[model samples]
Target: MSSMKDAREATFIGRRTDGTRIRRPLSPHLQVYDMVQITSGLSVLNRATGIAWTVGSAFLVWWLMAAASGPQALAKAQWFFSSFLGILVLAGMTAVAWFHTFAGIRHLMWDAGHGFDLPSTWKTGKAVMVATGVATVLTWLIALISW
Candidate 1:
C-alpha cells in the first residue's frame, strides 16, 4: 500500500489565515533623523579610523615579537616591511594611528560635554584631521631622511 500525503499542505507564504498576526511595524520609530555634532557624518569616519589603529597596533606588536626572537626572524620582518604590500600597510597604519588618536580626543571632549556645539565641533574635527595629516607626513619624512 502506497500512502501519499498531501504535499500541498506543507508551505508557509507569510501568513496563516486561522488567526496569526503577520509582520508588525518595527518598534522604536526612526523619528530622529538629523545629524548632530556628537555623532555626525565626519565623526563616524573617525570611529572607522580608530579601528584601523587597533589593527595596526596588532601588526606592530607581532613584528616586535618576531624581531625579538632572533636575527633571522628580524631579517624576515625587515624584508616584509620593506616590500610594497607591507609598506602600504605601514603607511596606512601611520595615518590610522594619527587619525584615531586625534578623533579620540574629540570624543573625550564630547564625553566631557565640551564640544557639543555644531560650529565648534566642525572646526575641531577639521583641526584634528589636518593635524593628523601633518603628523603623518612629518613622521614618514623623518623616517625617510633617517633611513
Candidate 2:
C-alpha cells in the first residue's frame, strides 16, 4: 500500500528523467489571445453586463423599498434619482439592461444550434450591439418625453 501511494505521488509530481519537475501547459488567457474579434468582445461584454445588471437591480430594490416605507422615504429616493449623478447611474443601468437583454437573445439563438459559424457569430454580435443602442436611446427618449 505504501509503495502504491508513493508510485501514485511520483506520477502526480511528474518529474522528468533529468530530475526537473515537468511544467504544465498554461490555459488560454486574455494575454494569449487576440481580443479584436467582435464575437470575443461581445462574449466578455455579455458576462460583464450581467454583473452590472445585478448591481443595477439593487438600486431598483432600494427605490421600491423607499416607496413602501413612506412619503418621506419616497421623497428622498425621488430626489436622489432626479439628481445628475443619479440620472447618470440610471442611464448606465438602462444601457446595461438593454445590452444584457439583447445578448441573452443572441445566446438563445446559439443554443438553438444556429449561428455557430464565424460570420453568423459576427453578424449576431453586431446586431445585438445595434439593437441594444437603439433600444436604450428610444427608451430614454420616451422617458424624457413623458417626464
Candidate 3:
C-alpha cells in the first residue's frame, strides 16, 4: 500500500494546496476569475463573436451549395439571404470574421517581435475593428448584387 501510494504521488508531481493540485494561471488569460468587468466583457465578446462566425460560415457554405445546385436551390437561398435581417446578420458575421482574422495577424506580428508596444497594440486592435467594418460593408454590398 505504501509503495502504491508513492508510485501514484511520484507520477503526480504538481504542487497542491489542501489535497488538490493547484492550477497554473492562464495567460492574456481567461476572464472568469480575478478580472475586471470591462476586460471580462471583451473576453466574452471575443469568444461569442468567434462562435457566431464559426456557425455562420455554414450559412455561406449553404449559399455556395445552393448556387451550385441550380436556380431553384439558389432562389430559395437568395430569398433568405436577401431579407433585410438576414443580410444584416450576414454583414455582422463578416465583420466578426474580419476582425478575428486581422487580430490573428496582429498576434502573429507580436510573436515575431513587432507591435509589442502599447501604442502599436492599441492601434492594431482598433484597426482590426475599423477595417473589419469597412471590409465587411464592401463585401456585403458586392455580394448583395451578385444574385
Q: Would you give me the overall lDDT of model 3? A: 0.73
- Tens-digit lDDT string for candidate 1 (1-147): 133265533332235487753543334423654454444656677778767777778778878998789889878888888899988999998888888888888889889989788788778988887998999999999989987
Candidate order, TM-score descending: 2, 1, 3
Candidate 1's C-alpha runs over 4 A off are: 1-39
Best candidate, lDDT: 2
lDDT of 3 by residue, 1-147 (tens): 134445445554456667765434334555446554433444455677789888898998999999999999999998887798877877788788877776667667878999777777667767776877788888878886875
Compute the lDDT for candidate 1. Answer: 0.77
- Regions of model 3 farther than 4 Å from truth: 1-46, 141-147
Clashes of 3: 0
Candidate 3 clashes between residue pairs 3 or more apart in a chain or in different chains: none
What is every candidate's alpha-carbon RMSD to the true fold?
9.5, 5.4, 6.0
Write down the lDDT of every candidate, Cα atoms only: 0.77, 0.87, 0.73
**Which ranges of candidate 2 are over 4 A from the true structure?**
1-21
For candidate 2, the TM-score is: 0.83
Model 2 per-residue lDDT tens digits across residues 1-147: 124444435544456788987644546788978786797788888999999999889889999999999999999988998899999999999999999999999899989998899988888889998999999999999989998
Candidate with top TM-score is: 2
